[model samples]
Target chain A: MKRLKKVGLIAVVCLSLVACQGGVPKEALELSPESLQQRQTQTRRFDTNNEAKLLTSGAQVLQDLGFTVEDSETKLGMIAASKDRDATETGQVVGAILLAILTKQAQAIDDKQKISVSLITRPISAKETLVRVTFQRVVWNTRGQVSKTEPLDDPKLYQDFFAKLSESVFLTANEI
Target chain B: MTNTVKKTACAALVVLLLAGCQTDSRDQVLATSESQVALRSIQSRVFDTTDKAKTQRTIIATLQDLGFVIDKADATLGTVSATKLNGYAMRMTVSVRDHGTKQTLVRASAQYNQTAIEDPLPYQQFFTALEKAMFLTAHDAD
Candidate 1:
């Protein structure tokens, strides 16, 4: 019983220390060697200097993808948008139900997520404009607590968006 | 041993009971343990450029390169804010202003998981990355 008490006391102190385990991660602001590769994945160049029109098309593409243009600055060639969507999957829901049945405890499944994106256009020169977009998301569980926060780094997602953006740029150019 | 156990139990109970009445919460708003001058020296850098727009764009590009999603940007104000979510949320803001006739001052501040980052190491690393993008050396600003 004395040993149990001592172990419990140590556990409490350890829990307190664990609660304080936050400092800025050393690599959080440091540029990793993959910086150039990540930049290439997030950026694309277009052969246009009509930056204002290009930004407009970028916003349109975001809207087409179910995002609300929360803010924009044509002078800076930037657009900020976000969308909230259901995050539940049938497989996870079924698994959660089975677990609840076995343990008689409620399991929190991912309830919803908000995806935010930033689209920026840099006019490298009069002939070339670099359009870069970055995406991140926050997922909340049914218990109303954050479950995940991550950046969207999928290359296919970027490729699809750029394909749509190219079509939007062409359509906007022709007033279609 | 019994006395010590009793004391520990009492202390744990007190902590559990007092968790809801944290006095630190009141001071969290606009609270910093570091002095203004010290934080200024840590977070600000100067570069030999007076073009505010280009400076802001470079900041944006650097932030994007670092896996941050640009949150907001203004050319006239020369400010950019970005957020990076990699299982944790970190938000950063960078501002540019003409420091003098021949130099521009850039300042950056960041918050990680809702806690302000006051350490100089992160700021130094950030400036190093910014230097790479700007192709100009970063000189600490007073």
Candidate 2:
């Protein structure tokens, strides 16, 4: 009876300490509204009336960028693609340590990361179409649990995508 | 006495560790009515062409060109939805209907991470870009 009472008391104290640790820190989970607004404003638009041609050109551009085209629908005017990135040495080591501490399952030196891209097309008129592209980076632990989901908001990245897309569109237009 | 204390400590640790694993769901804030009214005011555009299919196709193409992944498209209903994520997720849905035999109306709404984006600039920019694309598409048809 005494042992049970002592255990209960210890459990209560430890649980209280854990509770004080709290949930995932807000900073770690959410991006600031200012940054989100900046990102939204920074996203540029493209004008094209030929939905079919644009869809084809967009797929070609993504493929040229080394992204595997996962899905494409001309009628829907949407494409999904993903690229694989090899984790850096430091990342792997730190991931391993974190995994061992968190889930106790660590047995790999090579961790692979993935970046996904999604594109949507909207039409404003018979002669106009608007395109929006989004990029995301996902990191998974050896246990297959998602560790991080970061949005890629580099202006240069968007510029590069648009540049390639323009080239593809030109080629498609000229049939060259 | 020592054995009893050790057993008690182990039991306590187990219970505490299990309790620590509990997690809370993230909270989301609702948009104000003023923002909703403002968003509704600018979410629509009128196209010159009466061809609903062509207008719908152009909208889909424009979304694709902008790098949004199409989630759903319905021709009979004249509705399309596409989603994109850059840290935050945005879903844009467009609905097309005939205003007259020679004119079509397009309505679009954007949601950022499940919350309505009440800003008019993004919607205006999108419509402006769409207008340009429509011109290009018309040129191509010729």
Candidate 3:
């Protein structure tokens, strides 16, 4: 019985140490001014003459990507849309919770993850328009609290959007 | 046997309590001087329209115009929150209160990531665009 008690004490100490571990990395949560500047400049610009045409194509691209348009203004050269996706399967959530209990490390499963897109179109010149797109992801745990937000920095994602926008612009111009 | 179990449980509880005492490092980031400046720069606006519902719709439209996704809008609470992505994540919250029969008070706060945005350019630009939206909304009504 004494031996069992010692083992239990050791286990408790180990569990407590593990539980004290931070879930998110320190770097992931902090943003410096220099990093912010670098990120701000990471935008895709499309060459087009008609702002209205660009807006229409941009809206279509968002729709094709499974985003629902929340608001759009042609004059303002802005379009906002969002898409919600399930981040974890039901089985994964159950397993994670069980593991969390044993490990004492909180395993936060963001069940509902949201991706929001904001597009801005501007006329650089009489015959040139520039389009910039920004994508943000909001992660929410099962408790519906925002866990984290990540700026989508994948270049390919931006390329894909621009490619579709280019196609839509061609189609729109052809229609005119 | 019971006493042994009780002592083990107590020790575990104490450890857990100590772990909880550790402060989250994220709080340190917000305490920085830059973050404080950003927090102090939040701005508000007032609208001439008396219709609260109409004002709310206009606010939603305005945020959408700026490429913000409306996260939550509560008419009863007179609050609306929206998020946008530039190079970073930006979240904006607008609170609307009825000033009187013909006026409404609107206050807007913006944050970049977890810290408040101290730059006036973004806020000014947003409110400027919002002014246009309000004009357009009024024009559409007529």
Candidate 4:
């Protein structure tokens, strides 16, 4: 009986303690941009070769497909160009040019992830360009097997990831 | 004798009640702290990709298509750093790392508040949308 009484007493004490605490902490779940930037700066090591390789390969591919490759050497994975003289016709031609490249690359990757290749042309206040057709390619890779997959095994995922990157810049260069 | 005994019992009861309340509060706080830790563990797993570089490349492409030039971009285990071009009102960043290796898929979410967002410009929007798109890419959009 005495032991039972002691245990009961302990239980009561525990409950009382819980009722006194305050609300959530001010910075409990929030992240500041600075912290984010710091973390990235600390971790992200840039490889000029990686960026350069991708850019060169992309430009070469674009030229092989017959689109004029402006700025053979682009900095920081960016390429820009003025709009083609025959805007819509040129856009269609570029899209077709990209389609052939994408089809071949997608087959090579044998990827199962969904690839979203979007083309949007937002006006640059330069001229009669209704929309600047900027291309983007994305693959979900839900299995999250990107870094895990070898360049040979899931070449499509890697290829697609870079395909859009290269093509997006490819189009931008035309617009510049 | 009876009045004195009653007063002592009442005082003792108050002391016991207060102590019980204190213990309860302590346990709750401890439990909450533990849960928060667990949540963070889960969140980190959101970025558990075998290759973060490949993931970032795909996301960057999508962002470019959406008309936002990536300003500052980086990637790690389950996280990405990116800024939209022209200083658009949206910023896109996400952590795809989560804790559990084989159990829960999402590791950590940098864009938890963006689960409900529909905009295509923000990183969250692009991230989630890309997730859906990735599913299709992986499956070959049959």
Candidate 5:
């Protein structure tokens, strides 16, 4: 009887181990730095002139919206500023610009939003030569109206915003 | 026959199995699979059409409708080109490569903007849309 119980326990443990491993897929594994670098070497560069033109077009689309251009600059990348109220309202303007240019969905602007964005280089230890763009967008709502701002620390959101603004400004500058 | 001994043996077995499964190129295999699937989906749907001019029109129109300003739309070297709207300096290029057979490779790439140095979200979306468009076009039924 004791041997039977021991065998039963062993079988149970083995079944549990098999279950755990079966759930993990071989394709989901992460890669090492060396291999990642190897892949990066094959990365191709897209056309810069065409990229610049796209940014310019995006800037024009923003102007067509209701927001007035408070400030606009296009150098290497691009930055355009338009204000409606305080920081929050300005965020909505940015959000509205993003929505208009991105999804074509009209989103209301609020007055309590705060956002900040920054771009920097990788800290040396890792793989290929890559640039990092960071953004922070905060939104507040009261009485059915909402406001937003940029410069948030969210990498994903920041990346999207950076791409849109960059392409728009780049293309716009080239057009002129 | 103690519980500790059984558990230890099981743990050791698990470790050995895991160790055996490890490979230097495992990551590469997975990455290649994901990229291949993405590439295949894009190639299959975007360039599967017979009307080259109509394909170009659809691509430009869809991009423009998505708030991307058309910088230049040209059909050359079996490719279609367009730029983004207003302030984001992103561009999309669609290329069709014919290698003798009826198979075509449609590659759509959007810019990876570094200027603003603040955000890259817009450019990523632009790229995603380009890829998605290509995939949709290639996979469309005849």
Candidate 6:
């Protein structure tokens, strides 16, 4: 009976969450100053104008990162890839266990996460091509419910990805 | 068991009451307060250039600039789908086709989480951003 009440409470909380959500936020479609900064962070330019070559190298880098290609349009110079990885942390597990022991109820720990990436290449001119990549992730808890769905905006992540991509481009250019 | 059943029933009623019951949930599958033509006018625009490839690329760039991660894009079909996740998910699909010999039609439809975004103001904001990127005026597709 107590468990039933808990379920009801959870349902009510979820109902309130759904009810309170408004339409798309006002700034959702509008461009902001940070957009420029993010674009700079997510984009890099290569001296080679061969857009196809850049796309190929980008795919290779994603593969090296343990991501599986999901979609690509060579004509448009776009590639999408994703990887399913373990999201469990020892600290989170320990905390969950402690809370469960105190409350006599099991707490859901983070279990799995899927990180998705999109890569796009644009030609700036006859000699320059710009490659941009963005990443987002969906995390599920041990309960198999989505816990977090958000874009990954760590500048270092983008930097690391581009660094690998740059090396891949160089190696591919040299026929390595 | 009856006591538990009674409590469950009461809780379900509370859930319904808290939801406000503005619209019937069953009707959501095909429900639209706006007319089809009205929605079409709000979601579509015509550009003077017939360069579908360039227009699609510009749309991709605009979506990226608006903080969307591209999901899929098909040049042959002239469709690009992307999702923006900033605490919430906003999925948008932009399709480009020829309006005539000299004009290209670009239509974008977006859904915020589960609800379709039929609002005209948001669509206007989108076209404004897109036009700035394309360097072309967006003619209302009336």
The best candidate in terms of DockQ: 1
Fnat per model, in the order shown = 0.64, 0.15, 0.07, 0.03, 0.00, 0.60
- Cα lDDT for residue A122, model 2? 52
Better of 2 and 3 by TM-score: 2
Whichever of 2 and 6 has more TM-score, that candidate is 6
Give per-residue CA lDDT, model 1, range B53-141, as digits (tens).
Answer: 88888898889888898878878888899999998999999999989799999999999996788889989999999998999999987
**Model 5: per-residue Cα lDDT at residue A114:** 33
Q: Which runs of model 1 end up more than 4 angstroms from their true locations? A: A1-21, A171-176, B1-24
Every model's TM-score: 0.89, 0.48, 0.47, 0.27, 0.26, 0.85
For A33-53, candidate 1 gives per-residue lDDT tens digits of 887777787778888888887
lDDT of 5 by residue, B1-142 (tens): 9978977876776566544533564553444323555444433333454545444544543454343333343355555544432222344565555523544444565442221111223333433454454554333312
Alpha-carbon runs more than 4 Å astray in model 5: A1-176, B2-4, B16-21, B25-43, B46-96, B99-104, B107-142
Q: What is the C-alpha lDDT profile of model 3 across A71-155, one tens digit per residue?
A: 6655456677889998777887888889999999878776788888777665656766666677778787877877767767676
Instruction: Write model 4 residue lDDT over B47-133, tens digit each, in one string.
Output: 334444445444544444333333333343433333222211233454443224422133223321212122212323333545653
RMSD after CA superposition, every candidate: 3.8, 11.2, 12.0, 22.9, 18.6, 5.5
Residues A42-85, model 6: lDDT tens digits: 98888888898899989999999999999999888899889999
Instruction: Give DockQ: model 4.
Output: 0.04
In model 1 chain A, where is the ten-residue run with the lowest total lDDT? A167-176
* Candidate 1 vs 4: which has more DockQ: 1
- DockQ of every predicted complex: 0.56, 0.12, 0.08, 0.04, 0.02, 0.49
Candidate 5: lDDT of A136?
33
Model 6 regions lying over 4 Å from their true place: A1-21, A171-176, B1-31
Model 1 docking grade: medium
Interface RMSD score of candidate 4: 17.1
Worst 10 residues of 5 chain A by lDDT: A21-30
Ranking by DockQ: 1, 6, 2, 3, 4, 5
| Local accuracy of candidate 2 as per-residue lDDT tens digits, B32-128 | 5345555555787777787777777777656644545556677778887776544455678999887767677888887765446556566766776
